[model samples]
Target: MTTASSVSRGRSGWGSTAVAVLLVAVMLFPVYWMLNVSLQPGGGGAVASPWLPLHPDVSGYAKALRDQGPHLLTSLVVSLGSVVVSLVLATPAAYALAQFRLRFTDAFLLGILVSQMVPGIVVANALYGVYSDLGLLNSLPGLVLADSSTGIPFAVLVLRAFMATVPGEVVEAARVDGAGELRTFWSVVVPMSRNALVTAGLFTFLFTWSDFLFALTLTTTDDVRPVTLGLYQYIGSYVQDWSAVMATAVLASLPAVVLLLVAQKYVAAGATAGALK
Candidate 1:
């Protein structure tokens, strides 16, 4: 009976592992197909499609890099700027909301949640008029500020949730040692919540990186075009360059993929930090 039970448990573990692999493959198939399509030779009319690129071509990547490199740099700058602004603004707000029992705290949290429901186009349209009046419609600073709106509220919510889990005793001990609120926050809370901060900052980076709506709506000229807008040019009214489009998409997706791989450790640590405490 013992031998039979051991065999059954081993089979169950193998079955679970197989299902996990199948799920991962299903989720990754589109990425695989995009890469495959990007390597196909560019020609007129509908080119033949295949599961794999038997004869891979680099011309699409060459064209993509040549045309979209500036736009990709613009995206990187805007994304990094937005991360700085979001974390600086959201961290203090989150700490206050999580620690202080203010009367309007719930209302503020509600407003943040409701802001997510508002259409991006509506916000863009509103900002367009404001930006036009302020002479910021076709500028890098404008785009960074606009993209930051996407990260700020979400960062506030995420950081607030994590801050709520911090032990009050830890904060009080910092105060007892003669540290003021700001000092305590900077010295104590911030270090304790490093994993959570990293996780929030990682997501803020990605949110601003992948933003297309503000990039499309806020900027009227090519001076501040993001890679997403650059990708749109490959699909014109009459001609569609599928290989170049796929190539641009593959390049645009790299930051998100890289950020996820790098920051996933911090995210796991943050999630488990609460349980450990």
Candidate 2:
């Protein structure tokens, strides 16, 4: 019986390992291909060497950073601005939702969630008409506002979940000592849900950073285009520069990678906190 159990356990372990390997391959294949193309010399005209990079160059990176200066800067500014604004606006709302049992709280939460379900293109079209009338077309603030609207819902949801884990007694104790709602949130709730805040902030940063359609449609000039839209410019009607496009993609991916690495601890902690509670 012991021998049979050991063999079955070994088979299960191997099956689990195989499943993990397959999942990893599925996720990494596109990234591997992008890197592969970025290193290819012929720029996707025809592969001189199919399997390996014959000659890798940093020229693509240089062009993406130097030649496309305004787009890169615009992406950075818009993404950062959106994330900052979303966090600032969402944090207090999330705390209130989590701590208070206000009338219509469920309805309000449902409304926020429903807003996220609305298609981006639909919102963009409506906003486009409004912005054009208001002279907000081709504006960075307009792009930031659009991104923030989507980001705030998720931020509030995640932060509220984290905030819910905080013991009510602590908040009550602070309030009993004469601390105001803002003070209690800042002093008690904010400090307790630091991990969730970081996780939500990182997510907001990633979403705004990678947004394309809204950025492209809302902004007409290089000064307000995000990196995602800039990538489309690399492709022409007749041909595309695969190497440069891939390099830009790789560079665009780096910020999200760095964000995940930096906030991985927070993500893990927040997830664990939610699970344990």
Largest TM-score belongs to which candidate? Answer: 2
lDDT of 2: 0.82
Worst 10 residues of 2 by lDDT: 41-50
Instruction: Compare the candidates by lDDT and give the number of the best one.
Output: 1
Residues 242-275, model 2: lDDT tens digits: 7777777888888788889888989989766755
User: What stretches of model 1 exceed 4 Å from their correct place?
Assistant: 1-19, 44-47, 237-240, 271-277
Alpha carbon deviation, residue 259, candidate 1 (Å): 0.9
- CA-lDDT, candidates in order: 0.86, 0.82
Taking all chains together, each candidate's TM-score versus the true structure is 0.89, 0.92
Q: Which stretches of candidate 2 lie over 4 Å from their true place?
A: 42-49, 237-240
